[model samples]
Each structure stands twice: as structure tokens, then as C-alpha cells.
Target: MSAPAYSRPAPESNQGVLLARRLLPPVLREWVERLGGELATVCGYQLGLCDDRGKPTGGVGGKLLRPAFTLLCGAATGARPADVVPAGAAIELLHNASLIHDDIMDGDRERRHRPTVWARFGEATAILAGDALIALGFEVLAAQRHAATARSVEVLAKTLRLLARGQELDLRFESEARVSVDECLTMMTGKTGVLLGCACRLGAAHSGAPAEWAVRFERFGVHLGVAFQLADDLLGIWGDPAVTGKPVGADLLARKKSAPVAAALSAGTTGSARIAALYARPGQLTGAEVDQLTELIEEAGGRDWTIAEADRQVSAAWDLIDGLDLDGPARSSLATLTGTLLNRDH
Candidate 1:
């Protein structure tokens, strides 16, 4: 059920471009592992005697995209390649904290191919763990005394706030009949875009780049984030179950207010109305019903619309990257990464 005429490929291995790939040799892995372990401990909390879904869920952590961006920014700015280690770890911890909380709010059971922390540990514990991770992420960076500590702190704080607001907007959208395009863009910026921007900014901070390049790098990340989200939304609708690790039509099944679904609904096409009718019904929908909904979404042109949007953002990201005043392999690495993220299958 992949998007027709648009075969999104699996993201290539990071071996060539990512700071982690370059730095995670055995010795470096030890430090990353140590920092991760410490982060988990800092985030661990006893959820009282009572068990509830409010406790943390358990799963493998996220892909650490933000941290990687930060490290790459550092490399671009002339920081020693080795400096990415602590910086990446810190960024990863912060991202994981958001994921822990996000799962609880979304009541998601699965993440990274495992039960969510809230689903496994209970929501109460999960929330505590999330808070702990947030603190630990900054602590790790603070302890390292990286030259960019102050700048990193500022960026991290802003990123957290933006993430929270993004989640809030997502929740708010659940009850609305329609979200204006501007509002939709704003919500995405908060939910998915800003953190990536922060990652790039943190990296550049470490590199001691001029303020102007940091801004440009951040913009590049923002464009990348928007394109990444659009690709993800497209996948949620039409991706292969084997590749996406979720059932077909899972977003429709969950009644998620994703961009494609939203677009289809706004178009008010016949197929779109039929899908809405099916969605409005109570209890779990049958397999046939889910398929019907998928067809309707496609017929309404939601899939193609989102794909075009993804391409647009990718173009914008490339433009931003091209404008950056960067040097050598570091510049080339970021470009490769941008292309990789733009074309991922999952």
C-alpha cells in the first residue's frame, strides 16, 4: 500500500553522513552508553504504591534525530568532531523526555517496536521518568561545560516550550471541525519543526559559528522537519505495514487528525464524505471499512497533495542549506543528511 508513483525508500544507513556514524566507534559508544544509562536513572521515579496508566510506558528510545542534528551543527561550526558525543547525548535525552510525555498524552501503547513506558510502567511513573530525563539532558550538557553551554541552554529551554505548545495545539485540533492552513502550519512548527531547528542551533553553538549562520542552519532544520512530517503523514495513510511497523490505515483507525485526513475532509469530495461517515460510526471499523476509507482519501487527492507539499519543503530546506556559510566535509555531510531525511520510508 505504498504511495503510488512515489516509492519512498528506506533511509540510508547513517554511516556516511551522521556525526554518530563517524563518532560511535567502540570507545565513543561507551561514553554514549554511560550517558544514556545515567539519563535513564535520573528519569526513573517510583510511581507510588498505586499502578495506573499515568505511569511511564516502556519502549526503545527514539531515533535521536535531534541530537544528531546538534552534533552535525557543531561539526559544521569547526568544533572538534569528538565534541559531538556529549552534545548528541544531551540532545537525545531531551528528545526522549518529550517522547515519554507525548506517549502518555496520546495514550499510545507502542513505540519503537515496544510497549510505551506508560503502557508498561504505568502513566504515573512514565510522567516522572519524562521529567527526570528533561532534567538529566541539561545536566549532562552542563557537566560537560561545552563552550556552547549557555547558548545550548537557551535553545534547549525554547525547544521544550515549543514542543509543549505543539502538543497542546495537536490536542486542541481534535475537537475542531477544520484547522486553517496557517494554524496547521503553526501546529506543525511547534510539534515537529522547532526541535529540529534547536538541534541545528545547538550544533552550531558548539561550533562557534556566527549568529547569522546559526539562524540559517536553524531554518534549514525547520524546513527539514516540516518535510519529514509531511512524509510521515503520507506514510501513515499509505505505507506498507511491514515497513511502517503499523497496520494499514492505522491513522484513520485511530481517528488521527493528520494533515492528509484534514486536507481530504476540507476538500469535501464524495469519497472524503464517505470516509467521514464511516469514521463517525461507533466501535472498531472492519477491515473492509478501513480500505474503503483509504480509497476515499486517495480519490480525494490527499496523498498527492501531501507529497507535493513534502517536495516543496524539501526544496526550501535545500535552499536554506545552500545559503549556509559552511566548510568542507561538514557542509557536505549536512547536505547528505537533508536528502536522506527527505526520502525516508519510515
Candidate 2:
């Protein structure tokens, strides 16, 4: 299973993911890795043996940005990172659940430069694994016995529903003759924003941070989520396959409406009609067709609009960050994480 290397943003070590990485409450990383054991015992095992002497097939999955956020939030609220371990695990598990389900639905065979769970196992097994993750996420959070467990459950449930609604809109857009910019934006919000909000807000919630502060974190997450998704959509269209692990113009090939293409279609420019004509042609697209579609999306202002919109969302996120009474380490780490995400090439 020599898949390509995954190139998403990730903290590299216990020094806090990526060098120049100074670790705060360095023990935070231990708990983060422990989460892999928990997940592997479930979904990871069902797939195959672990890496390097049976280390769990799904060891320390992904960039772990969400759980890190949860831990940082706990630290900011004056709790030891260990105190919020359950919250961290729950957030990450839920996020992974979403990713697995998304890959299955999107027919993505590879992730993290390896076969997706559905591809390795079977679709039914993968679906069950995703469901198990979701339920396990709730169980871990509930076991924490935090005063906010109920609230967290409610938020997570709602976020999952929003994600489903967004996915529905995404599928519908693929077939519809037209989709509005507002509709597309709304879908992005549902698909990407709320879970991030939950991650940030939970940081405080797990530690009984005030409702006011929790709300602020939620706002910050909203801004961050929108920017994050837009950046992802940008990568989907223009990012390198060698780096991003998907073919060039993967989104265009799927003919699914992502931000740039949607913006292009709605721009009412000559490029808009051109894009529509190309999409309507159907069948499989050639490399030349993919290249021309990329050209049309840019001509219709889709690329610029998406970049600007992502920037706008980032600015809004910073505004929220500035208003928080976060401690020094948390603030610095947050700023670093935000920059890393914005700067990611794939």
C-alpha cells in the first residue's frame, strides 16, 4: 500500500506539531497520541495490522488540528491539557467519522496517502466504522462527566445534521442547472463551519469556561471554518496531485459544484456560459477539457473571489481572536495554527 504522501498542515512533534515547535504542557501530546490507540482498537483494527510492529493500522491519524484546538482551549481556560482529554478525543473522533463518511460518499479511494477505510475494507464495514466513531465520540464525552456534556452532545448532533444538509445540497447542485452564490455559501457554512465552532467552543466548555467565552470561541470557529473550507476548495481545483494526493482538477472532473466553479457560474460573465456548456457536455473529461475548465473558472472571477473571501473570513477570525482573554501561550499557538492553515499549499 505504497500510496502518495499526504500534504495537509500538521504539527510535527510533541513540540507542538512542526519544528520551531515549542511544546506547552508538553504532556498534551501524549494524550493526543493515545487517541490513536483508542481509534485503532476500533476502526484501525478492522482494516489491517498497524504500522511498525503492529502499532494500529490507524495510528495518530491526520493533522489532529481539532483535538489540538480542544486541548489549547482547555489550557487557555486554566485547565491542564490532560483535564480536557475526553473532549479532545471526542472532537477528533467525530471529525474522523465525518471524513470517513465523506470519502465513502464522494468515492474517494485514498486519504492520508492510503486506501480509505471503505476501499480497504468494504463499504458496509466502512459505514459501520463511521457510525461507531460517531457513537463512540458521544460516549467518550459523556464519560468525562463534565457539566457541559449535554450541551456538547446537542452541539455535535446539530453539527452532524448541518453536515448532512450541506452534503445533500452538494449532491443536488451537481444535477441542478443552476445554483446561487448564496446557496453555495450556505452549504459551505453547514458543511465546514459548525464543527470547527464546536471544537473551539468545547475547549472552554469542557473546563466550565464561561458561556460568554464559549460563545466567542464558537464565533471564532465559524470564521476559521469558512476560511478553512474555502482554502480546501481552492486546493481541490488548483492544487497539485503529487502534493494533494488527488488528480489535478479533481473537483472539476467530478462536476460537483465547489466554491470557485460555483462563483464562476454565477458571475454571469461569458465564462459562465462557457462553463455551463462544458459541464452540460457530460461523459468523461479529458486533461485538455480539465485545463480549459480551470481557465474558465478563473476568467469568471471564481479564483479571485474565493481567495478574497477566504481572506475576509480570516480577518473576521482574527478580530474574534483579538477579543478573547486568552493566555499568552494559547494566543501564540492559535496564531501559528491559523497561519499554517492559510499558508498550506495542498
Candidate 3:
């Protein structure tokens, strides 16, 4: 197949994107080239490797955070980043696959300033593309020659199961009259945390780190993932659309019981009662109501609570990293990357 013609410059500011540029492109190219059909076309479009017309766009896909964690954690075991490319690539592919399905489930038309795969193509095609990506993730990992390959595959499989369960819980929240903050946190951990933990564990395992060290790395990633999701929840309701690439209050429109929403609903404030009553009456909330809901969440202390909790999680992750006896520079890189993710606007 001839190479498609177009190239866009990647953003130079983020460390995760820089590291992923070194690791993901080759694997992504292989997937696009090897699939070689409608599956290839859909996957390519979904991944930002190409446009809907099957022309290469040089797009870099999502933030590449999971793969960056994989590579950085592997480096802690004194392995070169190159040595763990398969693990990083596997985690990345899985993460994108999840995003493809998630956009469909959330009924989101736009992500990263473009139509989502399901919106651009059709739902059936997007589902197939997501499935293909999941299989490719395992295929990439299984091809690795490391002793930890089998174990890594097992971890990946478990993470997928957890992701499915998490999605189930999220869907359930939409219709249920009441959702506790604790339930919301558990759902977030399952949906977001396990995959990141899998990324870190795969990295450490592939690099021949001891089992205990791998567990520690996984825990660190779990904490970081929670912080990441909390930040995302804040953005879902209040973020600038130009920066976040999605409409502000999109989650509120969907009646999603996000962390902040759940926190507000569970609080005993009068604002909380108003929010619950509004949520209970809704067909779809008007734009004005979404604006009101945003304020209600804040007034109920949900916004403040989420911000503090995210900070606490980040501190916990840092403490765990400090206790680990790892390569010094790799540890520093991990810390920098964590700060970058927590502070991002999008």
C-alpha cells in the first residue's frame, strides 16, 4: 500500500507525547498496514492516523499517558525504553480502544476537536474497530519475547474485564435515582485506574523487575489514575470548550453521575436537594439548566471536594514513588509526567 499523503506537526510541549513518538508510531503503522481492509480503514481513522478518506494525517491520537507510564516504569528497572516498546504499545492500543467504545457509550459526537469514530463512521464499524484494536493489543504483547509476556497478557485480560464492569456501573448510574460518592469512586477506579495500573505493571514486569516492585508501581499508577479522572470530572462540567475540545457541561446534559455530581448529590446542602430534584425531573436538561447544575455542584461543595481529593491522590502517588528504590532519573521523569497530567486543561 502506498503511504497516505499528509502530515501534521505534533505538539512539542508534553513529555508523554515526546516519549510516545519514539515508541507508538511504528506499532501503529504496523496495525494500519497489516489490517488492510475496512477494519484497517476504520481503526486508522479512529486512531487519528488517517482521515475518513483513508489519507494519513500525521495525527498523534490521545495524550499517550498510559504508554508513557509504561516506558517510565520500565526504566525504573534499568531497562532501556526501547526494550519495552511492545508493552507500551500494547497498553496504548488498549487505551484507545476503550476511548472509541466510550465515546459511543457517552453519545459524544466530538473528541480531540473531531468527530468520534462512531459519529463519523457508523456504530457497527466503530465497534468492530474497537474489537480489532483489543485483539491487536494482545497480539502485540504475545509477540514479545520477554519472560513476563504471559503474565502481562493475564494482567491485560483482567483489566479488560474490570473495564467492562466499570462501564456497566456507569450506564447503571444514568437511570438510578441515587448514586453514592463511594460508588462513584469505585466505578472510576474500575474504569480508569485498572488500565493505568496494568500499564505500570506491564512495564515493570517486561523490564524484569521483582514482583514486589511491580506491585508498588501498579499502586502508584492506580493513585495517579484516580487523580487524572478527578481532574477530568472537573473539566467535564466547567472546562472551556476551546481548550477541552468538548462542550462544557456535556456530562451534565447526559445526566452522568460523575464524581462531582455524585459528591454534590450526597451532600446535605440545599443545593444538593435542588440538584437531585432537577435530575429526577429531566427529559434532557436545557443549556440553562446545565449552567445551573454546574453552579449547584460547586455550591454544594462538590467541586472543592473533588479538587482536594485529586491533590491527595497525587501526593499519595508521589510518596509511593519516593519509597521505591528505582533509577533516579526515571523517578524524576515519572514525577514530572504526573505533574503535567494533573495540571492539564484538556
Candidate 4:
């Protein structure tokens, strides 16, 4: 099943990616080396800083969206980019840790066009690498001597708890006969939104923004995060595998109840009934069956519903940004970055 011929205009260059490429490598390299020996090597490979043979790859790593938000929000508060490096590093490490663990749990073999950590380095090594990353994230935050250091650590801890709860709900949803759209949204907020919100809040707080302004930044990030997850769900079903760096229909093939699938199943239409029947079948779905399920889900209005919701979330986020008392350039950059994220195909 080919995705519809829908395309978004590409940003000339993603400001977030540019910031991450400039700021993250040295920090990641120094901390990852602290792990020592095999653990250090595995973690480095997972972060795309080095090859499996432990040689430097000069890779810029993943999108680094969370860290980019941290840096941008910090800049909004008049902090120098270097001043927020610790916070950005902490968020990026935690994000990668979650990815490693998620790949192991979901049995995904590839990410960012390379074999996942668990696939290339074995599950036990991947687990250790993920744990090490978490420890490193806390260490980075704790090393900060600012007054907001303790509060930043606390925020990151809370985000981790929410992330774990989200993952648990996600796993549980796979076994349940039905899941409400509201429940799915809650799960995604915990799994994806809080961390991004935390990134923004930490940025503002650590950079000396007033408490009230930090709260507003957090709200803006939460909305943006929801929009990001909705976009990801759409990509899971219809995205080009080459662009997404995963197999086509990977979520559908695994029988995971993604947001669109849940919406389709709960639509209560004839197409919904057919989708449910297809999902309820015992064994793995063949390619043709997967294609049929994709068409039925779109026919049942799941695709349109998700697209509309994503747009709504993005608009809400932009409104929040507009109300902030940020400098004109910072405000524009944040809004532009949000659009870049919303328009991404991967």
C-alpha cells in the first residue's frame, strides 16, 4: 500500500538539527567515554558517534528534537546556548535511552537507517547501554552548580516516571480488546509529551526565566509534543520506509493498536468491522491483508481524524508561543522549528 501523494515543503535546513549537530557531539563523546570499555563502546555505537568496531563515525546522531527544544527555550530566556548545554545533553541522553529500550521491547530491528542496539549488540548489552545512558543523564544534570540544578533533576525524574507509565499502558493496550481515543491520548502524552515538556521547562528554568514564563514554555512544549506523536502515528502507517527508516506497515504488521487503528476500530462503521475482523485473526498478516487493512482504516476516517487533530495541536502550540514575551527572533525560530517538526515525513 503506497501512501497518498502528500508532501510537505522541506525546510531549507532544520534549525534544531543544526543546533544539535553543533552542540551535542563533544558532550556525548566525553560522557560516553566515562562508561569504560565494552559498555562505552556499545553506548557510543547506539548514539551514532562510533561504529560497532568502536571507531568514530562523525555522525550527528538522531533528530535531537528534545535537546533542540531545550536550547531554543533557553535562548528565549536570554541564556547563552553554552549555558544550557548540560540540560540539553541530559535530555538528549534520556531520549536515546528510551529509544534503545523501546526498540528492544518492540523487537524493532532498525532505526535511523541502522540496526538497533538490541539487534546488533544483543539484548543484555542493549539493556546495560540504556541503563548507563540514564545514569549519565542524571550525572550531567547533577554536575550543574546552578540554583535550578536540583529542580531540573526532579523534573527529569518525573518525566522518566511518566515515560515508564506510558510504555506500560502501551503494552497493556496490545492485549485489551478495546482502547478509547482518550486513553490512547493519555498514554501518548506520558510516553512522548512529558519529556518534551520537561525539556522546555528545564531550559527556561535553568536559564533564569521567571517561574511563570517557564510554565508557559512547558505548556507550549506539551502541545508540540502531542502534535509530534500524532505525526509519528501517521508516518507509521503510510510513510515511505526509506524515509522513515523502518519497514512499511511495521505497526500494522505487528498488530499494534496505533492511534489511527484505534480510531478506525472504534468508528463503528462497516469498514471498522472489517478492520476488527482482520485484526482479530490469529497469525501474522500477509502483505495483501495489511494493504487491505490500511485502506479500510483510511476509509473509516482514521487518517482524516488524525491529520485534523495534529493540525489542531500544532495551532494550539503556535498560539502559546505567540503569547510568550520572547524576543522577536527567538519567537520566530520556535514557530519555524515547530512547523519543521509537523511537516516531517519520518
Candidate 5:
């Protein structure tokens, strides 16, 4: 597939994304690229391919959402947005590290509209690349003489632990049945939510914001992360392949137990039973089977239930933000950013 850059919707007119852009030093972007290239080079050497020629792997990257969160949180915390660049780069690197392993675990060949690292470089190399990035993240943080408050380090470590626990739970879910909605939520929070919380907390720490403000920021990020994950689950089921960057019903084909699937199973309807039967099979799913499962979950109200839950989480996140003494161009920009997230097509 082509490696054209993926595009996101324009931020709201009132959004500070552009303002954040203005505040961001171009060096931050360059640093992220440099770090990524270093990690890739290490992977190439480890794989005995350092000198091999091939099409440049230009697009195994995402929207860098985590780093953006860190930068915005810094702005909201009264820090010069440029000051958090290292932390922002670290957050983005951490995310890509996780994604590298995730694609291997899911046996996926494509991500961000390009061949996944594992697909292009082999599984062992990809796994090592992910490990290298994780180590490099800590190295970056340690080397950031200008930032790196003790609290930021603490939050980052805690987030990393949570992410590990979440991934463990996700792997466990594949083999275990009877996953409750609560369990799934807890898993999502740990796996996806904590890192976002860490991103915001790191930003707040960078600015020397009051401890209470960091707490509130953490809460905001946690809730937003949950909502984002839920929306992602919904997309996995109902989204168009062209936009979602995957085959339609890819989740069903993998027999992955996402929120909607778990909700449908809990509904205990006949359709749910039919869907369960389809999932019980242990091999490649036919197109007919994929459609059948999607329909079964939608018919069982899983689709509606999951979407409602996502909206609730998103609203709760913003509600926390609303209570904060956040007003001004920065706050307006955040509001715009949140709205954009809620309505994203992919």
C-alpha cells in the first residue's frame, strides 16, 4: 500500500491547535523524527539490514495524539508550550513503542496506511524496535535537563505500569470468556487511559502548576482516554474501511473481545448467542461470518449501548475541565480539540 500521510479534520475555528502550533518550536517535531529514526536504525542494525535498500518506510506513524495532549496540558497549566517539547516527544515515542508490539500481537500487517514494522521488518526486529523505543523514552526524559520534575517521572512510571497491566488484560481477554463491562472499562482505563493521564500530568508538572491542578488534569485525561477508546471500539464494528484504515469488520474477523462485543454477550439475547457461536470458531473468518457477527451485535443493542457509553465518558471529561478556572484562548482551543475528537471519522 501507499504510505501517504493520513489527514485529520481541521480543528474548530476557535481551536488553539493553531495557537499551540504557534507556541511549539519546530525543533520539537524534529526531535521526534530524530528519535524515531534512531530507533529505526537500531532495529535495522539488529536485523542485519542496516545496509539493505528498500522503499523507505515513511508512514508507519499516527496523528501523534499523545504528544499533542501533553503540549496542550502544558499550555493549560501556564507553561510555555515550547517548554514541554521533550516530554511531548517522549509521549509520542512511548505510544509508538506500544503500537509496535500491539501490531505483532494482533498479527496485523498494516497500520497508519502502511506496512506495520513487523510486516516489513519481521516480527523479531519489530519486537526489538519496540523495546528500544521504550528504553529511549526513559533516556529522553532523563536527559531533559530543562524539565523532568520528580512528579513527572513518578507519573510516567505509573502510567507505564498501567499500560503494561492493560496489555496483559487484553491478551488474557482473548482466551477468557465472560468479560464484564466493568472489567472491560477497567482494562481500557489502565491500558489507554493512564498514559493520557500521564501526558497531562507531565505537562502540569513541567509548568510547576499546583498539585491540585495536576490531579484535575489527570482526571480529565483519564475520562477523555476512556471515551476515545470506546469510540475506537465502535469504529471497529461500524466504521468504513476507507476511513478506519482497516478491513471492514476487522475486529470480528480477529474474534477480539471489544466493548461492543462484551456488551452484546452480556445482553444474553439470542442474537448474542449466535454471535458467540460464530466467535467460538478458531480460524480465519469468512466475509459472511464477519457480516453475521456485526449484524448480531448491532441487533442486540450493543452498538447503541457502546456509543452512549462513549458519549458519557467524553462528556464527563469535559465536565471536569469545565469546572476548572480555564478560560481564554487556550481553553477555547481545548474545547475545539475535544469536539474534533468526538466527531472524528477515523
Candidate 6:
């Protein structure tokens, strides 16, 4: 979800990292910090950049993946990646804004292995900061010199509505003990996929891509977004805490009813029963209970099911690319980025 992880070239795939860094230049940090600081100052707050400790950490850039997609999609449509900087910046700011609010709502204290905005700054400051970023996202878009600014703004606005609706459904689902797989998928698409779709659509629109071309890119994003969230769900349970910046079995403790958890609940197996019973209780699950819940969910085919689903989604997204008029480099970069995202351990 974050492209900052690839901000610099990695040893394994320098080219991939180069591609990412090119899309998001080194100057990105300066602008991001300036905007964040300025916005907070205007509102009588002193929230620094997402990574700013007392000293400058420059921190985790928070995986600018969505904006990278915006840049790449524009390149596919014959627009230069550098030319899409405004759109990319807007998307990236909006994403971090969402992350700030999401952490508050989820009561999460950490992100990218660091303390969250609300955890460092007060809840009030975090909330206002998020609002400021959302407004800033629009301002960035409005100043975009590209011909496609109008269409991009329209899509971004619609995506915001979809994102809000998805968040609402997610909150509603948390209270319910059982949710269908379809419902979970819908929620995931709204929360994750829609924004990614916006990134792609906005980029292509800026490049003056045909409407149908933009639509195809959007669909590509839907598949990729679904896969991304599914993988994230798996990470919530089994990922190494050191790598994930989340405690192991984090979702189990929260009883989030993630796609994998939802699948396990419906498996009708004994393992499923145990998982359901654990979730039904009012108390927070203990560490041992979290381990047991995870094992049971895996036994119920939740883990394997989610892996297969993610793979399927990636394959579908790739298939959509075949229908697009992607150039050689853009197509290759897209493929490379997809593989990088899906194979990420963290």
C-alpha cells in the first residue's frame, strides 16, 4: 500500500526501485513536510510530518504505491511520469490522511513500525490534521496544470464518497458476529480498491486517455486492490510483528472479521466453531487465545483460501492489462510492481 518502501532502489530489484523513485522524486519529502507543517500551523497545531520525531527521521515514506500507480498509468497513456507529479502528490496526501483517520478509528497505535499520528499527537490534533490534508489534496488537484484536472477531481471526489461508505460498512460489520464473504469483499473494495481505482483513473485522465482506457485501468485497480487487502488480512494474523509493525494476531485480538476470518467462520468445521465462540465473547482475547484462534482459522481453510483468492485477483488484474494499450516500459513496470506488492512479506 505504501510505495515509500521502494523510494530507493532495493538490492534485489534496483530497477523497480528506480522506477518508483523516478515517479516520486527526492523533492517529494520537502513538499510533503512543508505542506503538513503549514497546514497544521494554520490551524494552531504543530503536527509534523508522519515520520518526524524531534529530529528529522525522514521516516518510512509510507509506501507511496497508490501515487506510483497514478504516475505509471499516466505513462501508459503517453504522459510523462514527471508530468503527473501534482496528481501523485494529491493522491499520496489523501492516502496518508486516510491512514491518520483509520488508525484513530481502529484504535491502532502503530503504523509502518512507528507510533501513529493520534498516538504521538493528541486525537484532536490528528483529526484536524487529517481534515487539513483532505482539503490540501483538493487544492493540489485544482492547481494541476494538466488538461485532465477536471476529470481527475471528479473521480477523486467520487472515490472519497465510496471510501466513506466503505468505512461505514466496516464499522457496522465489526459489531456483527457473522458476515458473508461477499459482504466482506464489498467492504474491502470500497475501503481499498476505490482509492486505487481513483489513482489509476486520475492518471490516465490526465494523460488524455480515452474514457474506455481509463475505465479499464480502474477495473485493473479493483482487482489489484482486492488482492492487496486480502494479503493485508493475512499479514494481520500471521506476519512477523517485527516486520508488520503490528502485534502478531492483531486482527484476532480486534476480532475484525477480515476476509480470512469471515471465511473461517463459515467453514462449518470444528475449528470454525472455536473461532466463532472466541469472537462471541465480550472480553478481549488473550495472547494464547489469539494463537489458538489463528490456528483454527487456518485449519478452517481461511488462510489458504485467502492466498488463493489473492492470487486469483492478481491474475484477473493482469488479464485486464492485456486489454489495455500499455506501452512496453509501462506494461513491464506495472507487472513488476504487481509482483513486488504481492510478494512483500511485510
lDDT string, candidate 6, 143-176, tens digits: 8667777777888888888988899999899889
| C-alpha lDDT of candidate 2 relative to the true structure | 0.72
lDDT of 4 by residue, 41-69 (tens): 88998888898889999865576778888
Write down the RMSD of candidate 5 (Cα, Å).
5.4
The residue ranges of model 3 lying beyond 4 angstroms of the native Cα positions read: 1-12, 283-288, 344-346
Pick by TM-score: 2 or 5, better one: 2
Give the least accurate 10-residue stretch of model 4, judged by summed lDDT.
Answer: 3-12
Q: Please name the candidate that would achieve the greatest lDDT relative to the true structure.
A: 4
Each candidate structure's count of clashing pairs: 20, 4, 0, 0, 1, 7
- TM-score, model 6 to reference: 0.85
* Candidate 6 CA-lDDT value: 0.74
RMSD for all candidates, in order, please: 5.3, 5.4, 6.6, 2.3, 5.4, 4.9
- TM-scores for all predictions: 0.83, 0.84, 0.90, 0.92, 0.82, 0.85
Q: Please report, as a residue range, the 10-residue window in candidate 1 with the lowest summed lDDT.
A: 45-54
lDDT for position 244 in model 5: 67
Could you give me the TM-score of model 4 versus the true structure? Answer: 0.92
- lDDT at 197 for candidate 6? 84
Compared with the true structure, all predictions reach lDDT values of 0.68, 0.72, 0.81, 0.83, 0.70, 0.74
Q: Better model by TM-score, 3 or 4? A: 4
Which residue pairs does candidate 2 place in steric collision? 11-17, 11-18, 12-17, 12-18
Deviation in Å, model 6, residue 342 alpha carbon: 0.9
